[model samples]
Target: MEVDGSKGNMAESPTNSQQTVSDDDEIDYSVKPEFYDPKLDDKDELWVQKRRKGYTSDAVLSCPACFTTLCLECQRHEKYVTQYRAIFVINCKIDSDQVLKQNGPKLIKGKSRREASSVGGETLKKVSCSACSTEVGVVDEDEVYHFFNALPSES
Candidate 1:
């Protein structure tokens, strides 16, 4: 019931200030990656081609082939399309240091192992009208793409 102000008791150690020194030496407790593999702080740079203002529209029109108003243009509500041959530019930077540099086949890896037989080495194939089999165009690593516009040009 009485307060023990003695040296070894609660108020006992007059050298209590020295106890803090021992506590400072306690193991530095901190969370760290278990498998501390040091990684380069560099980040892969990426650039996105911005769509031109005039190229994109919110109008729709009927399709010439199907005469269906439900085509891609008509669905978008864009009636008067700015007909232009689109050169789809794809920049494939193939640095010698990069394992899959400018190599489309190497990058795609020919589909999953389960789909090995179903797919071939990734190659740029000419896109043609599935219905008409018309040669649309091809894509490659040079960042150059040429295709005919199904839509009309801006008059």
Candidate 2:
């Protein structure tokens, strides 16, 4: 019950000699825990990906006339869209069956003015709105797409 004033009123920390290290509890000094961004790493696979691959809200591309959902455009399909002549060519698998359904004489493919530029040398047809018979875009002979919907510029 006696209070000893021998030690000073200060906190004492253990010296290096007093510190302990174990083989199993090894510390990695080379690598540190950090927030990793794939775009910043040269060796990362995404590093080779588009530097200007713009981030856009997930969009549903539709027929400009009837507003029928033609395709779902996102960052994944954005990479496949390329420039062909004066129009942008969509060379990815979109929802073609529902968008380009045949009813009576209504086929998605109308005669296109675009040259014979296709994936397999097949003739490309202008994509028409199945509901409104409006020329929306173009498609290939394989029933796959090379869609040419020009997004209206915002003013």
Candidate 3:
């Protein structure tokens, strides 16, 4: 059998003359929202109060990089294992296939302190903006929930 060099075999390595481009050298491709739009109606008075107090619903966790609606904020709970640590659990209804199509190869695996140590020791998959490659949130192995770094539309 013949091996193709272009297929990136183990023996294939780019030389300095190949002109490799680092991620930093690439142009900024982060997606920015032209306008903020809350797709869902804010009818719940408790939600309004929470939003005013800086807690937002799932609609607010839109990605700043691609303006993708990442996850919906469900509720805030105290981390029982960690003192003074509060976690906002988020729910995502989008299909995993759709998420992969939008986020692309930016989804990576890493450890998060927010997740319970009992559940795989905080190791989870994180999704980033496909365009700008900015980390937006994390998804569990089941893709039921995501934890984001910023509020929706804040980016």
- For model 3, where is the 10-residue window of minimal lDDT? 80-89
Model 3 residue 125 CA deviation in Å: 1.1
lDDT of 3 at 85: 12
The local distance difference test score of model 2 is 0.43
Give per-residue lDDT, candidate 1, residue 85. Answer: 25
- Mind giving the per-residue lDDT tens digits that candidate 2 earns over 72-126? 4322244545312222223222233333333343444323324223312445455
Off by over 4 Å in 2: 1-58, 73-120, 150-155
Which candidate would rank higher by lDDT, 1 or 2? 2
TM-score of candidate 1 versus the correct structure, residues matched by position: 0.21
Per-residue CA lDDT of model 3 for 1-155, tens digit only, reads: 34566985556456776777886777565855556456545545455566447654424455555555444344332442111111333332322332221233344332434333333333345455554556655555454344445344321
Over the stretch 1-155, how does candidate 1's per-residue lDDT look in tens digits? 23575654554444656556666467565856576645522221111112232344233222235322211211121332342223332221212222121244243423333443245442443334344444433333453322332433221
Clashing pairs in 3: 31-65, 58-72, 58-73, 60-152, 61-152
- Count of backbone clashes, every candidate in sequence: 12, 1, 5
Tell me the whole-model lDDT of each prediction, alpha carbons only: 0.33, 0.43, 0.44
